[model samples]
Target chain A: MADMIQIEHLKKCFGDLCAVNDLSFRVKEGELFAFLGVNGAGKSTTINIICGQLKKDGGNVKICETDLDKEPDLIKRSLGVVFQGSVLDKDLTVKDNLESRAALYGIHGTKFKERLSELARLLDFEDLLRRPVGKLSGGQKRRIDIARALLHKPKILILDEPTTGLDPQTRTLLWGVVEKLRKQENLTVFLTTHYMEEAADADFVIILDHGKIAAEGTPLTLKNTYTGDFITLYGVSEDDIKKLGKPYERIRDAFRVSVPDTHAATELIIKNPDMFRDYEITKGKMDDVFLAVTGKSIGITGGEQ
Target chain B: MNELFALTKRNTKLYFKDKGMFFSSLITPVILLVLYSTFLKKVYDDSFRSALLAAGADISDSVLNGCVGGQLVSSLLAVSCVTVAFCSNLLMIKDKTSGAIHDLTITPVRFGVLGFSYYLSTLFSTLIVSFCAALVSLLYLAVVGWYLTAADVALLILDVFLLTMFGTALSSCINFFLTTDGQASAVGTIVSAGYGFICGAYMPISNFGNGLKNVLSFLPGTYGTSLLRNHFLRGTFAEMKNQGFPNEVVEAIRESVDCNLEFFGTKVEIGAMYLIICASILLLIGIYITMNIIAGKKRK
Candidate 1:
């Protein structure tokens, strides 16, 4: 896939504080890329800069090979954004809100109606179109927000924590819609989320911490490279776990070590099962790998240790 | 232009959704008019009647009569105050709170277009409220036997439009200074109240001395109330000329009033230049603040 979004040495600062420090990344065309970060991470800031809602202190961003600074209007025309907070006018019915947004892009005539109907059918929003947004449930409102963003048939879709406040069932429903968009329209998606499950499905993921990219790779590559299969560990206290030495790692408050295969771990377990009382020998999941690489637990307190 | 129309429609829909705002704008003017009318009636009967009697020649009947026109002016003032305080401040706050402004900023739309659309919506809402107040006042005047003319009606509509623009501009300025909705509304109320008193919204400018009168003439509301009074009570533009109120003094007042009214009319040729300037300044400040927010969010 061609490079859809490219950021090189992007830096943003406020006074003495550096919000995004020398950030660089590239999102491929037709790829569902996940930007995973804790609260207060630079995810939203980076998204804002890409969307031209903000001016960067120094750096470059390009969309579809077009420089954001040089042709902001052209770039903006190619992108759609669903902000973290609700952006719908509460007093307006879902249909009216969508129609107003359509009008903003100057979409009109029979084509506009076709687009509206298409989005309504795809998002299952037809039933709720006449309902006032204020009266809709949180999940319904989110669907409407998504529909509004997709009204103009943008080449790229940026969802900023789109399912943060949604229930699990609703989140699953939204994820399905996202998947459909990716497959059906070949839309490039750059989504920010704290949900590991959400990021797991992305083609690529960028883990951010404290205004910097902590790690970046596909989910499987990141896990395989940063973590290992399994090994039983013994003789480690809460304080001693930190002192357990090289190659051995900690996962979820327990000391762990990776071995070549299950037989090796079993032989070790057979020898000293009591040594692994608080510890467990198992295949490393993405969460453990993320923690191992970033020195912090995924979805934990600001993704900190 | 299409974008602006869409924005205007969206804003109008939002305004209609807030039932509390709609009701407050509708009923508050009537209550204020009634209260002020009652108070003026008591004062006229108790003190003004004896004073008129002392001046001689059967002034009792006229003295006993209520100042329905003054009540109308008071109602208009009340409605203007509420509209300015509620509409502009809330609109600004909603943009920030709801994150809609951020969405618009990221779009292809220019800030100028967005600001103009908001001002247009505010102007429209204020016009509707002012028309409703004027209709109620006209009913009262009819009952009390006060004559009105077509030119007077045109003058009244123009007066409301000018005041609404001024109020929208003032509120936009306040919104830029204050970050929160509560602070914006509080500051807007105090500012509007101060202007209300100075602009002779509650009293006759003629009672004040020359220095104060000159200061009052500089106020936007002063021009609005004068134009409105010229229509509803003083009769026609030609009649105003024949009243013998001193051409020089009247001309001075007219010139000063004309400055405020004409600032949005022929002199400016924009219909909303002052408002546009105020919005531009405030919008620039707001953009700066938003940039800071983005920077702050990034560093964390």
Candidate 2:
């Protein structure tokens, strides 16, 4: 796949503090690439720089091989951005907002009408067009924002935590819309999300931590490299589980012994049948991989116990 | 360009929909006109009128005519000043609080376009408010048998246009200076009030001492009121050349008056220039700030 976006040694600093430090990444064409990070991680900032809402301190950003600094208009023309907030005008009806955005990209007349109709169908915005945007629910507003961003028919769509604050049902609906767009338009999607499950759907994930990429690879590869397969150990009390240090892994309330294969699990179970009777073994999930790489567990309530 | 226009139109509609703002902008002038007319009738009694007449004052014609014109000009200036100070600040704050500015920044639209669109909307709002106020005052004057020529009406409209432009420019500049919405509105109110008092929007500059008159005369509103007074009351642009003062003081008044016109014209020019310079500067600053925040995000 061709490189849709290329970033080289990008850096941004505020006074004495560095916000994005020496960051480099490439988003391939026709790929749903996930940028994963915790809250306050620079995901939105990166999107801002890419969309020309913000500027980098030192770096070269290229869209389809056109340098952003040299040709921001050309680059922006081919890029669509859905910010964390719903950017729709509250006073205007949804249709007006969409029409205005379409006109911004110089889309009009028959071409605009066609795109509007197509977006309305795809995003389920048909019934909501005449209504004032301020009256819409949060989910509907987000959908309108997505529609507005895509009206220009951008080559690359940048969604900055697009599903944040949404209910699970809405998130699922949005995901379906995104997936459909990817398939129908061959669009390259650059999405930022803290939700591991959402990241799982991406072809590649870049886990960001503290202004740097902590790990980057296909989700499966990163999991395999950073974590281990399962080896269940029974007859271990809570205290015993805590004492079983080095190689033994405790994910949530379950204790697992890392094993190279099923044979190792079976041998361990046979050695302590009574202890293993109540235990079940499974492959390492993305949560375990996240814990192993960051030395922290997914959904851990507080500091380490 | 089309997008900007669409945005402007939407904002203009919003301005009209705001009942409190609409009333203050359009109705406040008429209310002031009524109040001032009643007050003048009581103060300018027969004794004072005869005294002024004995002193070579044209009490029979110019006093009544000028007083009518004065009240109209004062009410219009007050309305425009208040409307610009409050409405423009509110709009800017709304954009910031609602994330509209962030949304605009990310779009392919340039910052210059966004700022220009905002100014255009403000200009439109001022014109509407000013016209409504002038129409009301004209009706009141006609009922009282104070007639005006076509030239007077034309000049009055022109002066209102200049005032609207001045107000729009000041509002844009205020938005640029203030960051938060609350702070912007608060500061705008204080500044507007101070300027209104200093420019003698409610009183004649002639009532002030020499030192104060010198200072107040430099205000754009002062020149605007003088030009307006000359047109609506005296019915000639040349009437503005001399403000009924002694020869030595007349030069000082002219100098200060000239400064205000030059300053008002400069504001219009700056407003146009700000479409480029202010937008670019703010955009750059916003980018720099956001970039660092993003960098911080990468660390976590």
On lDDT, the candidate that comes out on top is 1
Interface RMSD of the predictions, in order shown? Answer: 4.4, 5.5
**Best model number under DockQ:** 1
For every candidate structure, what is the RMSD over all alpha carbons to the true structure, in angstroms? 7.0, 7.1
Docking class of 1: acceptable
Poorly placed runs, candidate 2 (over 4 Å): A231-281, A296-305, B17-69, B72-75, B78-86, B235-300
Q: For each candidate, report its DockQ versus the true two-chain complex.
A: 0.36, 0.30
lDDT of 2 by residue, A1-305 (tens): 89999999888877777777888999998899988666545666677788776768988889988898877778878888888778777877898777767777778779888999998898888999899899999999989989988888889988887887788888888989888889988899998865677777789888776668888999888866786567666557756544434267666756777765556667766765656656776666766666676676534221221
**TM-score for predicted model 1 compared with the true structure:** 0.80
Candidate 1 residue lDDT tens string, B40-59: 55653455445434544233
User: Fraction of native contacts in model 1?
Assistant: 0.60
> Could you give candidate 1's per-residue lDDT for residues A1-305 as a string of tens digits?
89999999999887887878999999998898999776656887899889887789998999999998778878878898988877878888888888877877778668788998999898888999888898999998898988988888899999988987789888888889888888888999998876777777889989887779988999877766776676545557646444433356655645667665556667765665556565556666667756776677756334454
Q: What is the number of residue pairs that collide in model 1?
A: 2
